[model samples]
Target: MAVHGTVAAGFEGVCEEFASFLEREEHDPGAQLVVYRGGERVVDLWSAGVTAESLLAVFSSTKGAMALVAALLVQDGVLDLDRTVASYWPEFAGRGKDGITLREVLAHRAGLVGIDRGFTREELADDRRIAELLADQRPFWQPGQFFGYHGYVIGALVGEVIVRATGRTLQEWYEERIRAPYGLDLWLGLPESEEPRFLSTLPMLTTPEQQAELDAAPYSRFSLGGIAFNEHAPDAVELEEFVNARPVRAKGQASCGGIGSARGLAGMYAAAAFGLDGRAPLLEPNTAAEFARIHSAGTDLVSDSVKQFGLGFNTIAGSFASVAAGSFGHSGAAGSLAFADPRQGFAYAYTRRRYAYPGGAAPENAGLLWSVARALR
Candidate 1:
């Protein structure tokens, strides 16, 4: 599991930390780590089975990109966060959901987590289909009262508003404004030309004890967590299968389904927060502050776990010791995490082909991030 790629001068410690983690893994994780300091790529490294250009499914890390697009629209006065969702898309008014504001939806407080009848794989591949199914559905909890993680459909939920208001899909806006402009490798709607670099996500390899823990865990497909992940469906899509499918990759469902390399992910954040290639930053300081500030905190109603969210993005500082207080990003089910730390003047991304045990934001990120912080000092 030899590490590949190079680090900028004086960032040798970050490389060491990456290689050290690879040495300890029982199986090669096929991981990539990329970091940027104010638009400069400081560290770029990958492990066995993946190259710096290799694209992998970034799961919910896709949310970070989704949020950024929303932020840009907001900054440009194209979308108003305080506006009621129904105002933009009248169909959303069905079933007592007329009052949920765009702001509440961004904060995961709109309470439209999922439908009782889960989506088919085809519907899950397309954001519009997912949005249409849940538009008239009742909220699991009173909107704006309790926050739940809209694990699988937050993108579609918000994306529908984008479609209605802007007359363009969120993915389209992302491509025209962000991805294409920056020449980033990350793709919400991956093109056929990029298929060769894409690698299907590998399933998590769990130990017997871990398997036992998973089996023993209290879980039911009917529960909120289960529904959020669409486990209630008769032909539920597995976490890995969601992005691996060609349709999902091509359509780019938004909640997940993003295909990218670590370089692409990290570079996106850099371009968003620090202006890459001599261009201006995508977000103004005020817009970044608004999106990065924690809007929801405490135990998540859906997952029943402590989580904090800042308008569709994870408020990273509270969850990870090394991240700055205003840092905002998202992690994926496959152990990928990407974010921009405005205070630190850095953006970071880590992706793995093999899903890590216990899912959501691989545990290795803590040590690796700390090492990056140390290198900064």
Candidate 2:
């Protein structure tokens, strides 16, 4: 098990913890991790079967980037957090959703998590199509009355608002405003030239016991969780099936279509909260604070788990104590986690090629993050 890459002084424990975690994996989990304290790169490492340069499907971690774009719009006065979403996209006002605000949607409280009719794979991969379908679809719950993790459709919901307000796609704005200026490896829409570096996300290899646990609690495709992930579609596919498609990677659906290495993920957050490459931080401290404040908490209706969200990003302090509050980022379904812990003065990112058991953030993050946090201390 060859682990590739580097760490600055005081961060050797992070690498050791990573190696220890890998030793227990039953499969080659192919992972990358990169961290930055302020603008300086502190830890940069990856396991075999992946490299520092490989671009893996980052799943919902893409939402962090999408959220950043939305925050930028809010900061720029192009988008208002408190205004009705329908005020920007008139069609969104239909189906008793006229009152849903951008704040609620960003907080995953809109209840327009999915369309009852289900989305075609094509529609799910395209933000515009997804929005069109959802505009007329009824919400499963009263708008703004509750919170559920809108796993797959959140980016489309916000991206539609962005497009309506700016007359530009989220991908286009991301490229010009964030990715290109920072020279980030993370891409909302990967170009043809970058294909060689793109690594398709691998599926999870579950043990029999783990398989049984999943099988025992079967969910109807029409259930809120199932619908959020588009599992109800006639041609429903695994999470990998959607991201592995070259078309999806190329178009880069904002919710989960991003592709990048751990370095990119960490860099994105570092840039947002701290200056990078001799530049000013992308977000003002006031702006970052507003977005990182907890907007939703307690049990998540869709995932049926304890979760919390700020405006558009996941808060860091709740379940994972290693990172304190006032931090923000997101995890992908393939065990990827990326966030900036402003309180701790570092941005951390970990991404896996092989899916971790039970999905979302990988179980190994605790040790890795704890080690990094200790090293920083």
Candidate 3:
């Protein structure tokens, strides 16, 4: 397997590591990796099966972008983190949720994971519809008492807050304030003109043993993880199939509907932390720190495992020790990981075309990220 694209001085190790990882893969895991250092594109590489410009559905990594938009609103005083969600969207105050703050909702503490009856595909892809359904539903737990990853509906929840506050959608705010201004390849909603650039996400190809392991898992459609992902929905489809649809791509549901390349992912974070092409960074240092603070840390109720979360970003410092404290980002279901290490002054993004074994961020990210960290010294 050949690794393509260029790297800046002192970053050749990232290219070698990427190539070695690709060579070890049993399948053609087409992937893209891009990094930015202090407003400069430092590393740009992708495997042969995919191109630099390929727009892949980056699963939950989309959440990082949504979180950024929310952070911007907070920074601008358009939204207040400490304020109750009911203050912005009165309908959200139902069923003991009157006290759920904007901060708690962003931290995945509101427990509005999914609706009583799971959403249809159309409702799932439409932020407005998802919010409408969830506003009246009972939360799974007391708001802020426990934190679970709201896999599918967190965006609809946050987007609803943005809608009630600004009278416009988070998707629209993301496009106007972040994506378009930075010329990011990432899209909250992909227009028809860009359809030709999309590469449909592929499902994981697993061995018989791996398949057996997956089947043996005790996950149920009614379990917290299942409902969080809407597996309980009558019309539920595999996550890969969700964004592969044109309507999902067009709507770009904030939770998981993002479409972009590694370039866009890296660029967005770079613009957030380091500024881009002579423009100012989107977030001030204080605002970034506030969002990156570990708001929730422990066993995530949805995943049933230890995880760390900031306002909306996954705090990376806990798991990846080399990552400096306050480093933040989110990983996608298809093994995409993107983040900004403000302490290191670099932003990194890695995306794969195929679902990675064991899901979440691909294991290779550690070695790849470590290589970049070493090169920065």
Candidate 4:
């Protein structure tokens, strides 16, 4: 295994072992894993073609970043979670959504799960168009009644609210408040100069036989299988277009499209765990406590599996039992994982270019992370 970076103090052996594990798993391409314990980085490692400078698209892991942005605003009294989102962005009041609170929106309980309006890649770049579409859309379920993962809609809702309250787009606010303060390399809206460093996500594999089997399955609530994200045969050309295009990168979809190194992601969580660079708290103690309170603890409507969700981050029970119980973070579509354990004062992040394993359970990269976490304990 080609280890590419040094592990920090007290964790050199852990890093070496993780790199070897990755090699044994045949995890080709690049990946990074960073762990910060008690305000000090103890495990900072990258392997294969990954580097300290390499930044991968961390799909839904961006949700944690978005949640932090909202938490900061809430900390400063610029936004109130209990207040109706319409209280800030009045247009959001349309379609019987006036009762939806910022808390509910962040908690994925606002019922704006799947927008019926089909969005082309181009339409994604226009925030106003997306916001308008979201404002007019009806709830998929009773607001605050259940949790349906709002794949893309939550970003529009939260971003618009942030803009209305702070006079800044979510990306700008994140840069000024979070990224700039910490000198983190994370970018919500990737700049053209950084385009060359970006790694495209491998398309999810699907075959004609698989599609036929999926089509034959009965429509039931508990059924796990369904049409893949790319329903047609895996088209490499379209996959490349989707990942490398500017429209996708510039869209500022907070649920995804975040570009950052694993170190940067780990650093952000470190800042969240401790304070940001010796400044005042990014989130007040009570606010963080409130945010960590689990809101839903059952089968998610979208994933059709049991998931424990806190205010913004998913909880560490059920399938996430391996993670520390109090830990909070988000996982991305293909294998990216980031988490913060306030109890241990530990924060870690792992980002990969190639999709290692499929489905909800953590992949080989995550297993290595768990091993390191256990060793540190």
Q: Candidate 2: which stretches are off by over 4 Å?
A: none
Q: How many residue pairs clash in all the candidates, one count each?
A: 0, 0, 0, 0
Residue pairs with colliding backbones in model 2 are: none
Q: List the global CA lDDT of all models.
A: 0.92, 0.91, 0.92, 0.71
Backbone clashes in model 3, listed as residue pairs: none
- Candidate 4 stretches with Cα past 4 Å from truth are 27-29, 204-242, 359-361
Q: What would the per-residue lDDT of candidate 1 be over residues 276-354, giving only the tens digit for each residue?
A: 9999999899999999999999989998988899998999999788889989889999999999999989999999999
What are the TM-scores, per candidate, against the unseen true structure?
A: 0.99, 0.98, 0.98, 0.88
lDDT of 2 by residue, 127-177 (tens): 889888889988899988789998889999999999999899988999999
Off by over 4 Å in 3: none
| lDDT measured at residue 142 in model 1 versus the true structure, 0 to 100 | 93
Tell me the tens digit of each residue's lDDT in model 3 across 1-377: 88899999999999999999988997878899999998999999999889999999999999999999999999999999999999989988888889999999999999899987899988998989999999898999988999999989889999999999999999999999999988899999999999999988888888899899988987888988889988999999888778999998899899999999999999999999999989999999999999999999999999899999999899988878668998878999899999999999999999999888888998899999889988998
lDDT minimum window of 10 residues, candidate 2: 233-242
Give the Å error, residue 40, model 1: 0.6
TM-score of 1: 0.99
